[model samples]
Each structure stands twice: as structure tokens, then as C-alpha cells.
Target: MAAATHAAAGRVSGASTSELGAAPRPAPPAIQRVRRRRRPSGEAPPLPRHLATSGKLWLALSGVVLAVWAVVFVTDSIAYVDVADTRILQAVAEVRSDPLTQVAEVAGGLATSGAIHVIWLVNLVVLVLVRRWRHLFVWLVTGLVVVNLTAVAAAMLQRPRPFEVEIIGRWSGFSMPSLPVTVLATFLVSTLYALVPAGRPREIGKWVVCALLAATAASRLYLAQDHPTDVVTSVVLGVAVPLAAFRLLTPNEVYPVRYRRGRPAHLDVTGARGAAIVRALQDQLGVVATKVAPFALSGSGGSTPLRITVRAHPSAAAEESCVFGKLYAATHVHSDRWYKLGRTLLYGRLEDEKPYHSVRRLVQYEDYVLRVLWDAGLPVPHPMGIVEITPEREYLLVAEFVQDAVEIGDAEIDDAIIDQGLSVVRRLWEIGMAHRDIKPANLLVRDGTLFLIDPAFAEVRPSPWRQAVDLANMMLVLALRTDAARVYARARKQFSDEEIAEAFAATRGLTMPSQLRRMIRAQGRDLHGEFLALLPYQLPPVPIQRWTLRRVGLSLITVAGLALAVAVGVDLVGSPL
Candidate 1:
């Protein structure tokens, strides 16, 4: 019995040991599962790889291009090529000698008249309405800046006109870079920049436009308005300035996205927080803002002088910050107080705090117009930020201001001013843009320089009706401010009576006094005035000719068929009889 009990105890103990060994051990302290990280799908694209990797290469290439152009320019300046001169003189001699040439010249002259300018101006108005203000502003500002710069340069250079040159019409001033050539070249470049983007179409369009511009420049040389070197230099500067400006000002990213179904898309700002945006802009533009005593202006919103000044920094450059701010404020604000404040501050008050509604609307329109101009790489204020002052009351736009500037009206409109103004208007018309509000107030004269401003009411598409209105408005403004007859005479020298009439018609609403209309009518009755009237009325004859020929051909064919039918009927009736 004792042996059996001991065996049973051993068996039970062995079974208990086996059961302990079979039980699962607690899992080795689990290692946390590692997860792969990923970036958000909507993250902004990083800086372009080419720009990042080959920055020095790009700089080197730019330098090379400039160097090549400079070498070519210097070579041309030292040695005069008379190819254009000889060809032109020959053509002019032919015109004088041959009756056909004279007839052709008259026809061409009639064809040109003021029709082209009117058409171009009308087109510009349409573009402006379509929100292409940037393009218009850029073209106008560029032309103005170029003309002023060229005038100053011409004055400085004071190069004499070609000796033994045939006296054709009237010629004056020192001609190195021909004003017409420069104007034409610059105008073409600005227009191309405005119309074409960097793409296949742009590439093709640029080539065609450039060819046309070259032909135009050559024609100026043929007309003896400029030397070859002058034309070449003008072309070089024309191409260079806008290209550099475009590179500097135009952002790589698409902006002012087309409104979807007429609804404005929210601006895609890199920094949404206001304080951060301000700081970032300040850092980027080298602006120093010092608080000045708050002062109330006569208009609406109270004005506080921020005393915002710009200084050139090691990293950042000083540009027109105040002007940029003003533009921004004008564009972003919906409140009457801010709009009134901006306009009042810029133009100042005429009556005791009364808002100039026309001026106010003009300012707002200019805000939109300036955007198109800035984008097109024309000379204007560099925009920084739009400041909304209180959610409902006021807003301040920050821009770079033109320092040490004077108004064009501060002094008499000299021949130089008239020439510069005409050149500017011509270029704007060429690009299908019009500075509808062309007045002395809008013309900023800084250091004998003319800068066109207040393009809010401007248009950017082809419309003779609108252009005529713009012209009439400008004429009226000039008449009211300065010597009406002198202004009219100067205008008549460049624009025909028809163009003036069309402009008057387009802006007929601008006539504050019926007396102005009567004055225009009386002037239009004169022989010279009648010639002017004929200018804008001469629309392209090609379309009308084509339509007329088509109709005549169709009528002749119908008459011939009717005759044949009658003969056949007569023959059949005789046979039956």
C-alpha cells in the first residue's frame, strides 16, 4: 500500500510539471509598428528644379545676351550703315517723279488717316472692360517712360540730324535713337508682352510681330525719321527693358485666376495671416514704416501717415512701396470710405469734402487697369499688399511712391511734352489700349518726365466708338485746363477731325457744357477740321471691296441664267408653232 501511494504522488507531480511547460509564454515585449510618412497631395510645388540647379548658369546666360547686344550696339554706333537711308531717298525720289507713286501715296495716306489709331483705341477699351488693365497700363507706362527717357537721352546726346538729308515735311530735335523707331520698337515689344504668354502661340506670334515691327522700324529709316543705328538701338532697348521687367515683376505662378462663371476666385496668398504677410513683404521689399501723427483728409476715411519709407538693403531692393500700397487699397476695397479716402489722398479735394464721383469711379477702374499693366511689365508702381482697415469701413493699399516727382500741368505743355504725349498715345492705340482719363492731373511730371496715371476708365479692345469718347474726354479736359485752341491744334497735327469726333461721340457723356460741343462742331467745319474728321471714318477698305465684288459676281451670274432661260423658252415656242 505504501509503494502504490508513493508511485501515485510521483505521477501527479510529473503531470503538473508537463502542464506548466505547455502553457504559452507572454509575447516578447511588442516592438511598436513603424509607419511610412507621406506628404499631402495639395502641397505647393517646390522651387523649379532648373532654377534651383542652374541659377548661376541662368545668370551667366543673361550676362552673355547683354554682352552680345552691347557689342553689336557699340559696333553699329561707331559705323553708320546707309542702306535704309539710300533706299528711302530712292523711294521718295520715285514718288516725286512718277505720277503713279503720288497717287499711291495719296491712297495710302487716305487709307492710314486716323482709322488705325481709332480702331486700336477701341480695341484697347474692350480689353480694359474685359479686365486687361495690366496690359494697357504696361503699354502706356512703357511708352511714356521710353519717350521721356529717349527725350532726355536725346537732349543729352544732342546728336545732329543727317547732313544733306531731304527735308520731308518737318523734322526737329537731336536724333540718335529715332523717337519713332524707339516708340515703334518699344510699342511692339510691350504689345507682344501684353498679348502673348510664354507658349507655342506666343513664340509664333512674337516672330510675326517682331518681323512687322522690324519692317516698321525700317520704314522709319526709309522715311528718314531715324538712322539705322538709331533704329537698331531702339529695337535693342525696346526688347531689353520689357524682358527684364517681365522677369523681375511677373511671378512664376499663375495669378488673378479667371473668375469661374463670373465669380471672382479667392486670391491664392502664400501667407494668409495679415501680420505675417506685412512682415514678409517688409523683409522682401526693404520697407521701413514709422508711425506719423494721424491726420484726417477732406474726403472720407481718416488718413494716418505711416511714414512708410523704403531703403536699399543688402538682400532687398527699394522700389515704389507707397504707390504699390495705394494701388492695393484701391483694388481691394469695396467701402466708399476707403475708396473716397484713397482718391482724396491721391488727387486731393476740389470742394469742401465733396466726393468727385467721376474721379472716384476712375480711381476704382484704374485699380483694375493697373493690375493688367503691372503684369505686362510696363512702368508703374510695384504693388505690395492690400490693407483692409476695419471689416466694413476702410482699406489702405500699399505701393511704391514716385519720389521727387512733379505734375505735367505744373508747367506749360511744351513741344517736347506734346511729342512725348502723342508718341505715348500712338503706342497705346497700337496695343489696343486707351488711357480714357488723359488729363494733366493724371500726367505726373517728375524731373521733366511724363508718367501717365489714373487709367481706371481706360479700355483695352478695338472699339472706334469708345476710343472717340476717350479722345473727346481728353480733349475736353485739356481744353478746360489749358489753352483750348493750342491743345486742339496740337491734337489735330497727329489725330484727324474724324478721330476727334469719334472720341467725342464715345465720351459724349463727359460734356459738362453744351458750349464745348458747339465749339467742336465749329472747328469741325473748317477745312483742316474736315480733313481730321475723315481720319477715323476710313475703316479698312478690303472688307467692303471683298463684299461688293462677291455681290456683283453673284448678280451677273443670275442675270446671265435668266437671259439663257428666256432664249430657250422662245426657241421651244417657235418649234411647237
Candidate 2:
């Protein structure tokens, strides 16, 4: 009845019946976007509130504590420090029984230089087993700084151990903040951060370590090994300095102490963040995500690939609970910049080698391309917009998951699939866009249709060379599935012999993505050479090494920056403090 009424109205109004019968589109749901500063290339994301404030607090506390110790004792500006030291020392000396001293002596042995050697040996083994070079370096550097600073300060003050007190326990170079206890405290803090994962385990470890350190301090004081002032000062430096260093450099969120089997680039999708992802999808995107897990992580290095299961949504495509998402964080942004910068230095601005300034921008590119490609009648997942996870710090780019589809490499690639694959590149050319990263992993087959994913590297109106390389990569991927002859035969249908020849000419070393390059090398396949043989006549190979002023400038800056980092590292290692 409504269709009949619409037709009558269309005739009366002189409008097309189809147009009058068409359903009105639903309004898009509102979404909130975090507009924090787009972190510049090579810049780390801003630290979490607790991490930043904690580091500053420790630094300030240590400085103030050191300053007070210096004035009270080092300069003898105040008389209370000595009197307190003497009374504490004399009282400790009163419990000088042989058995008690022996016990005290055994406890104090933990602070000896020998104990440091043992701790380092164990820590080195653990760090190496886990391949935590960053943590190991920070741990060693913090120890060096603490140890050397102690020596320099003690020497400058020349403060004696105690005022006429009989020394029962083993003694060290200086009295101020017994060196053994200080070393022990610093090592404990380093162990907690570098080895233990955060949560209840780390929180409990903190208490255990604190108790141990307190025991050590009491044992030293009981043994009459040093003045009370020295012990107090040592505790402040040992705990504060390393805590600040680790928190600032190796943030738990960025470089977590995970004992997992995957690369650190993959963020943990479990726990609070996982639950939050579920909740965010339900509230913001109207996606009732029942399950969210890391998906096909081997191919994805820049962002964490997530397979989000949708319980319900307005879109029928999402009814099967097949939603794909990529979690982008600060680390991915920095990685994209470095990858592009390296390409720039090596190849001199090969079409669209510019890095994104922020993770949001990096992800928005993929979201934008998905929309553009889908609208252009290309085979790509429907883009479900970006879901803000940690405001600007993290976001998830959600889209259709292409459920039950397998990689073209793993799937049976028949002539239909091969034709669809070549047609994709042809469509790309017609539209003047390029999927700069066309490889096997990015190519998926679902019911004989070829789909492209990971549009983070896609560019519109790319150079002819860039477009040509896209053709070459697609052919290589298709050819790998079947023989070169079949793939090339189908490719010629959409592209000319000259265009096919040009594709091979532009394709060579460094033209392909890292994963594709590795797979080709590992399989001992010369798909490149095979594809070229199929070309009618090979043109001269495209020259990729185009050196420009910008390339030269970036190359020089990279070299200079590396040299400066090396120099600073050497100075830090060689310095006494």
C-alpha cells in the first residue's frame, strides 16, 4: 500500500518512483574524538599521570634529602646530626654479644660488593633470557650512577664512620648511608621493575622488598657499622633515583615486563583494557562486542590486530559478529615515522613516504581510505569508525572483519580469484590511487573475491612509478598462488603489455614490503624474474635511488643523531658517576 501511494505521489509530483520509494538513511551516531597534541614523529606519547608525577616526586625528594644530609653533617652547619649519630652509635654498640654480632655480621654481608656481583649475574641471565636489552641497560646504568655518586660524595665530605664506637659488623669505604644497604636497595627496585609484571605480584613484591631493606638497615645500625644519618641518606638515594629512571624511560604501558611469546609491539588485549574495549564498543559504536582477541599478529607489526565479536549492531554486515579492529598507540606512531624515514633516506621520497605525526592521524588514514575505496566500488571492509580507548593515547580502527576469509597464500587461488586480484590493481589505476603495500598478507580471498586490507599505506593520485609497483606486487602475490603464465595472462586482460612490462620494471629490491620480501627469499622463489619473463619486452629497470637535497639532509641528520647517541652512551658508561 505504501509503495502504491509512493508511486501515485511520484507520478503526481513528476519525481522518479524509485527515488520516492527509497528509504531515508539513518543518522550516524555521535562519537567523541580525543584532540590531544599530535605527537611529532619520533616523539613518545605523553606519560600517564601517575608515572610522570611519581618520577618528579622521587627526584625532588632525593634532592631535598641529599641537601639536608649535606647541610646537617657534611658541612656541620647543624649540631643535631652528630649528637644523634653518636647516641645512636653508642646505644647500638651496647648489644655487642658474640652470637648477636655474628648474626648481624651475616645479615650485613648482603650489602658487600660481592653480593652486587651475584645480583648482576642473576639479573643478566634473566634479562638475556627474555631479551630485555632496554631494561638491562637501564638497570646497569642506574647501578653505576648510584655507586659512583656515593663514592664521590663520601670522598668530598671525608666523613668518618662513627665517633669512638667499636665497629663489630663489616665496614665499607664511607659511613654516610652504608654503601651495602644503598646498593641492596637500588638492586631491589631495579629487580621489581625489570623482572616482575605489574599488578598484584609487583605490588606484593614491593612490600617484601621494603621489609628486606628495613631488616638490612636495622642490622647495619645494630652492628655499629655506620652513623644513623648515613643509613637514612642512603635509603633516600637508592630508592628514589632508580625508581624515577625506570618509570620515565621504561613505562609499564609502553615497554611492559611481559613474559609473553609475542613481540612487544603487540599490546595486551586482556585485563582492564580488554574489558574497556568491550564497553566502549557497546556504548559508542553500538557494537556489543562479546569477545576481543589479538588476531593474526605475525603480519601486523605497527598496530595490534584485533578480532572483535559483535553481539548486535544496526549494520547487517556486523550481524555475524565479524568486526576487525587495529589498536593504535604511541609506539605504532613512532614506528610508522621511523619506517618512512628509513625509506626516505634509502629511496629518496618514493611516492608517499611521509610519516604520520600522530597515532590518531595514522589510523584515520586507514579509516578514510576504507571509506573512499568502498565508495569507489572496490572490495574492502565497511569502515566502522574509530573508537577512542585511551582518549588520544590509544584508539581502535573498527571495520568489517571479513569472517571465514583466508589469506590468498593459504587459500585455493583459482582463475576467478586471480582475475579478481588483477582487476583490483586495474581499478586502483583507474581511480588514480595506490595500495602502496600490496602483498600476500594484505590480500585475502573470500568466496572468489579478492580483498585488500591494511590501507594505512594507501595514497591517492600516486606517482606512475608507485602505481606500477602496485601492479607488480599484486602479480607477484597472485603468481605465487598459481603459475606465472596464468596470472600474467589474466593481468594482460585489464592491463596492456606495455603496462605489464612497466610494472615489472618498477618492481625490485626495496620495492616490496618486508614480509613479502622475506617470504620470497625463504621460499627461494624468483617470482620477480618469472613475471618479467612473461612480459612482452622488458623496459629498462626503474631507478629507485633518486638522491635529492631533502634525502641528503635527512641522511646527514640521521647519521649525526646516531653519532651523538653513541657519544652520550659512551660518556655515561665511562663516567665515574
Candidate 3:
């Protein structure tokens, strides 16, 4: 009864007692696994410790290498080491002259041969093995061949070598594009790619290899087998070929970065327009804004002077930027192109007389003439900006406006103006320059100081006849406004009447229409008579004929009109009687 009760209790409580018989707990149902949280896509894998350590080591090595190279460069400069062509020439001479030097020559030749062939073979083999890399292989091969050919062609041109020829051995090839130099360069580059690990240390290793290759190439020239230029060409071809090949093969390897060193990185603004320009400039350069201002005021081309204002950014603190402005004279719908006109009223006759087409080109031509005059040191306004009008109008030139200068048309011609004008003519002769358009508007007077202006028709050439004509034109223009005696007296003080005659004689050859001459003679009768009386000779016969014709024609017309008036008056009197 006691045993039966114990068994029953154990069964009911589900407790494990050292029982003879017990139902085994059913094995826990195969664990229903909980799902794990998914990681975000494109997450970076953790860097391996080995790679990180390697990179740090490489950076340290590169630092050390750069430091060493710097030291060597400085020391070499200070010590005056003749490691260039001169040293190499000396070594080559010693080797060639001495019988025992044959060993060294053979050794060098063997080394060069080995380096050149070995690298090429390796690259070719690797390219072949990489079956799907035909494009890369083709680019590499093509680049190498092109560079080699270029070097060879340049070498054959045979530019003189930097060093004196100390031919201890017979040298046959041209002194440029050294073949051995090319070989060494190509070999080192190709080998570096194959062997050097990719990191900072690898970069340093590459530089080291390059330096060694360069040194070896230079050695050949120093030995007198090649010229310095030849060796340089070889090195260039070697490096350029492989790098070009690599770029072609791995297009993604190209990393371009714009470097701005001493240039201003700020946008300069002077006004609203300038602000917009500054913003655009900033966007382009990826820099900040420094200052702003309204652009300088300049003149434009047209019959009416148009003023243009513009904003600009200086390239540097010391540099200036060139800006071109445009001005329209009228809203005329004559042509498809815009035309500009000069604002100064001085251009009124020109506008009325000349064909009104393609004025901007003409203005540009005038600007060019001004530049020529400026370069010749003539007293013309310093041109700063140019204004382009439309195709039908003239342009306005923005020049340094002579603030105090008086226009010759507005000023009285005193001895000072006369003397200054003569002096200008003399200077023009000295510089072999001629100002074709010598009018009153082209002359300026400042505080009794005279300056030649409007050199748009000036020419720079060695022609005394042309210069004489230029002087004659000036004298004629002056005579039109001033008393001829006064002008001649002033001009004669500096120039002989014979010289003046010679100038006038030269002027006669210039194309002046008979009609125009007649008109001018009628206008200048008083002026001409006074001038001729002062001179050693009478006025020219052609001018006298034109003057007489004009006078006779006027007298005949007057007589005819008077006769008609008398007849009409007599008839009226008879009717009254």
C-alpha cells in the first residue's frame, strides 16, 4: 500500500525520482528558429588589419623617400657635382680610350639589352594569358610603338647636342631620342606595375625606379653613345608610352583635379550685373565671393555716343580683365545685324558721307589703328575698351578721356599750339609713322599743350613721301580754320618753305576730285592768297584755275538775276505813268 502511493504521487507531480518506470519527457519540439535582423544593403565591409597596417607603413616609407630626395637635391646643388652631361662625357672618353674599358662597355650593352627585352616579353605574355583583355593589350602595344617611332624620328632630326663631342668611340645615330634611354624607361615602368604592391610604398618604389631608369639613360649619353636630347627623348617616350597604355586599358584610372594656387578664389561684384557675374564665376570656380562693384563706364560706337557699364573679375591682384561692350545707335530694322555709331558729333560728316554697312568691323579696324599709334608712342587717347555697334552702325571706343584737353576746333591757335603740332609731326617722322586723317577733331589742346588724336588712319612704315603727305594733310586741315599766314609763319619757324613745298607736292599725288578742290579753293581764297604771299612761290596753277572758275560762275549768275529784276521794275513804272 505504501509503495503504490509513492508511485502514484511521483506520476501525478511529474517529478523524476529514481523510479523503476517513468514516461520520458517528449524531446522539446525541434526549436522553431527566430529570424535574424537583415543588414542594410551597400554597407562597407570592415577593413582587414593587415591592409591597414601595410598602408601606414607605406606612408612612412614615402615620407622618408621624399625627405631623402630633397636632401640629395640640395647637397648636389651645393657641392657643384658635375652629374650631368659633362660628367658622362668624361666617363665615356675614359672608357673608349682605354683597352680594358671594353669590358665595361660590353656589360652596359648587355644590361640594357636584358632590361629592354625582358619587360616587353613579360608584358606580352601576361596580356596573352588574360584572354578577354585584347583591348588593353592593343592599346599598350600601339602606344609603345608610336612613342618609339616618334623618338626615332625626332632623333633623326639631329638637333645639336648640349655637350661637346668627345668621340672616343664611333657614334652613328642622331643626338636626340636616345634609344637606350627609352628602353630603360619602358622597362622600369612595366616592371613597377608587375611587381610593386599597390599602396604609398608602391608609389615611392615607382618613383625610385623611374629615377634609376633616368640615371641609366643619362649614363649612355655621358658615355657618348647618344646625345643628351636623344637620351631625354628616349626617357619621355618610355614613360609616355606605358602610361598612355595604362590609361587606355583602365579608363577609370583617370583622376582629374583643377589646381588653383595663387589665383583668386572669390567672386568680385561691383553692381547688380556684377553680382550675377560673380555668382556664375563662383559656381564655375567653386570659390567664395570677396567683393562687388559696378563695372567701369566706357564709350560705345554710334552717331550718338552710347555709354556702357560692365563688371569684371580680375585674374589676380595685379592683372586686368578685358571686357568688350556693345551700343546701338538706333532701333532701325535695316539689316539682320546690330549696328553701332560713334557718339561724338565729330562723326556726323562720316555718317552722312560713307556707306552705312558693317560699322562694327570698321570700328574694330579703327581700334587696331589706335593700338598701332599707341605702340608708336603718339599722343592718342589710351584705349581701354571697345564698343561694337550693329552691322549698320559705327562703334564707340572707350578710351582714357583726356579730362583737360581742348579740341583744336574749340581752341585758339597760338605759337604754343603751332610749335607743339610741328613737334608732333617731327616725332611721327622719327618713328616712321603717318597719321592719314589729320583734322581739327583729331587734334587736342590741353593748357596750351597740343596732342595728336584720332590715329585711326595711322600707318607705320619707312616712307618719307607718305610722311610728307601726312604733314601736308595736317597743314591743310589747319589752314581751313586758321589764317594761312599765321599757320605758315608758325610752320616755317620749324620747317623750310622748300620742305613745305615738297610736302604739298607729295600731297598733290593723292586722289582729290576736281569738284572737291574747287569747293575748297572757293572757301579758302583769302586764306590761300595770304599763305602764298608769305611763301617763296605763288599758289599752284590748278588751285588758281578752280578759284577763278568759281568766282566767274558766281558773277555771271548775279548779273543775269539783276537784269531780269530791272526789266520787271521798268514795266511796273510804265503801267503807273
Candidate 4:
């Protein structure tokens, strides 16, 4: 597990006196009393071991390759003065009239000024439009440096073209490192660097790009346009330039995650920005002259909410004052635009996708629901307040921290704990609400008490089917975490057989959260099989429903968006470059 951290007061160290202005107002007694004297250390947890190892290895390998290439290029340049390099060029010149010359000429065409410039221009435009500033910088700088280096090396070496030996292709300029090969190779490799996802895609892309580069280099050499050494130099430049640039410009993470219009791109909730968020909370609380300390916890990786623990200045009463805050920001996901569009077209009439809903609405809804649950005497995290970090970009919801709590997956669950967990669901049902997301992570156990947290997906007065889903998910999650027979036997204490039947029935269309899916997969537990083994009833397979207006509309919209994406892709492909 990789962890990055920021201390509340660390950023103030080098600030001017004016910048270290007065802190926010003191919080209320209830809020202030929970402040803790001890703070989490500022040290960041080492990045995931694999990521750190791979990054160091990648940089080391790139440096070695670049050095070797540089040595080879310099050696070849010096050797050319004695026609030692020309001997190799002269041998390649003998094959100029072969049919392979045409193939080589066509391969060389991919590196023409028009093709190179067009591809570069289109890629640049896409980068700018998508606001990929770091990638944009890297792409632009790598291209400029590679091109200028190629030109300078060519001019300095003044390696003559192979025309002296009856080279077949029409070509000009001195070529020690073939300019066309250099340009095309860099362009292809750089594009792959920018777009390829990690894991298998990256591995496959690397091989494919290498093959293309090898073919291009071989063709340029066989066609007698550039010397064999020139092509080799180009291949080396192609690999080294982009690798070096990305190392310098990109984040240290093996796979850096990007989000849009959220907390500042560089600021995680645990850093100086977190301190600012505390100030914002103070403003909301109308408290003046209070210090806030925030400790960020590891969030669900990628686009989920940001979670942090904040402690305000202690009050005279000295109550343990720690508040848990969850933040929602517009994350930049590759599928977000299409997902949003599809959501709009399909379920525009029915807005149930709370996770992907607007930040303001999501925060407000969760905060309200938490308050409702807390006020109703349910075992839930107490709602503190809500803060708007940015109008639509980011928002935070503060709640009472469940002291000494651990996720159920980390807890020693027994029959009593299972019953306590069921009580929470029963209480929610009694209060006419349903917590749509009930899983191990959401259930906290402390001192034999169970508390439910993060009811952002809960619904007031939900349909019977929705309530059944809540029960089913809760029971399924509980069963997976603890003993299935024990959970089933315990569940019978509070829930009727009919209700259990309804719970299983409602699971037919239940869309399991990603976290639960991962847990199920990791544990190698078959949920449906377990359910049947426990109950041993034939669950009638529900008929697949026909497309409703929402489904149809969303389908059409998705198809249209994909079509538009394809058309844009075609235009990009077909456009002159």
C-alpha cells in the first residue's frame, strides 16, 4: 500500500509573517473537545514496493541505453572520416535496385515532413483540449529536442548520403542519424508513451512500437537512403528521448492518476491544501482562532471520495475531537464523459447514480442522510457539517469519527457482532431508509459495537425491492466476511424467512459495488453458490426486462457517442499529416 502524507503546519515553515496570518475561529465545545495532542508524523509511507523498484529500474535502464547509443553515435561519426562507416553504407547501396527498394521508399514516406507535422499537430491539439499539461509539455519538448539534436548531429558529422554508391531512393541532406527515421520513430514512441495504460497494454504496445521501429530502421538502411549506423542511431534516439523526458516531467508513480477540477491537482487532502480545507471548515463552523490538524487516510484508489481525519483546537471541556471528512471532486476518468452522457440520455428522468452525481448534491445528500441516521439514534457516524471547497468542483462532508473502529474485514467478528450489524440495517429499515451500499468496509466494529458509515447511497422511503437489496448486500457481505452458516443462523434472529427470501430475490438486479466485487474475487468465494448452499432453494431466474425509455435512450446516446468518437478518430486518421 502506497501512502502520501502532509503535515498541517509544515507548509507554514517558510512562509512570510503575513502569509502565516491568524487561524480560523475556535470551534464549538463539542467540536473543539475532540482535538488530539498527538499528530500523525509527516513522513509518507514508501510507495508500493513494486512501483518504486520498477521506476528505479526503468530510469537506470534508460540511462544506460542512452549512454551506449551516444557512444556508438560518436564512434560512428569519427569512423566516417576514414570511410569505415562508408564501407557499411556501400554494401547497403548494392541492393538499391532490388524490389525491396520500393518497400523501403514507402516505409520512408511515413517520416515525411507532412506526415510527421500532421501527427504532431493533431496530438498537440488533443493534448491541449484535454488539459494534459504535463504530457503536452513532455511531447512538445521531446519532439523539439530530438529534432534539433538530429539536425545538429547531421550538420556536424556531415555524413554524405549513400548516393555516391548508386542508392535507389531520391533523398537529400547529410545523414549520420537518419532524420526521417528519427522523426517517425520519436513520434510513434512518444504517442505510445503518452497514451498506453499500464500492465499488459503497456507491455504489448512496447513490443509493437519496437517492431515498427525496427522495420522502419531496416527499410531506411536497405533503401540506401541513410547508412546502417545512421538508422541505428535514430532507433536509439527514438527510445531514449521520450523515456528521459517522461522520467523528468511525469509523476513518480508507476501509474499516475489524474483528476479534473478537484482539490488542486498537486494537493492531496493530507497536505497544505488539507490545511486550507480545515480553514474552510472553520469558516463554515463560524469558529475563529482555532488550529486544525488533518491526517489523510488512504482512499479507494481512483475517482472515489477522498477521506481525511481532522482535529481542531481542543476546548476547555477536552472531549476527544476528531472528525472524519469525505470529499467529492470531479475526477478525470477516461470513461467519465461517455458515462455522463450515457447517464444523461438514459436515466435523465431517474437520477439514482449517487456516486457519479454532482459534488454538491452528493455531499449534501450524504450529509443529510448521515444527520438523519444519527438523529434517529442509529449506530452511525455523527454528522458534523458540510464545507464547499469549490462550488461544483469539490465539496466536503464532516462527521464524528468512530473511535477505535476497524473495518469488519479487519475485525474479529462473532455472532454478537453479526447481530449488531443486522440491528443497524433493521434500524435503517425502521427509520424508513435503506443503505444501498452495505459491505465490510462500511461496517465498523469498536468495543463490540457495530457502526455503519458512508450512507451516501441510502434512500428515504425506498421501494420494497430496494430495501431487499440493502438486506441482501448486507447479509451477503457479512456472510463473506464471517461464517456463512453462523451469519445465516444469526440473521434468522431478526429477519423472517420470507424477508430472507425477499433479500435473495432482490439480488437479481443488484449492481454490486466495485469494492465488493474485488473482495469476492480475492476471497475466491462464490456468492450465489454460498447463498444457495445456505438456503438451498431454487431461485427462479428473473426474466431479462425489455429496454425502457431510459435504457433505450442511454443505449442510443452511448452508441451515438461511440460513433462520434469513431468519426473523430477517423477524421484524425484520414486528415493529412
The per-candidate count of clashes, in order, stands at 52, 1, 30, 11
lDDT of each: 0.45, 0.76, 0.46, 0.61
Worst 10 residues of 3 by lDDT: 22-31
What TM-score, over all chains together, does every model reach?
A: 0.32, 0.78, 0.32, 0.54
Worst 10 residues of 1 by lDDT: 22-31
lDDT of each residue in 86-133, candidate 3, tens digit only: 565665565554544554454345225455565555665654554313
lDDT of 2 by residue, 376-495 (tens): 767787788887776556788998777677988889988777777776776777678999989888988776667778987899998999999998898888877688888888765566
What is the descending TM-score order?
2, 4, 1, 3
Q: Write the per-residue lDDT of candidate 4 for residues 1-577, one digit (tens) a residue.
A: 1121123123322233222221111122254432222223663211211224544665566577557657756677555432665677677667566577768777766666677777777777877776665676677667776777777778876867764555666576887667778777778877776766544677798899877777777676666677776676677666666766665455323223243443222235444445556666656644332333433233233233443434444643553355666655544232244444545554352235423446566677778898888777777776767766655655667766665678877788777777766666666676789888787778777877777877867889987767767777777777776767787777666665556666776574334555677787888887756775777354554332435676676677778966875555444344221
lDDT agreement of model 3 with the native: 0.46
Q: Over the stretch 263-324, how does candidate 1's per-residue lDDT look in tens digits?
A: 11122223222333244334433344322212111111212223243333334344322322
Q: What is residue 89's positional error in candidate 3, in angstroms?
A: 99
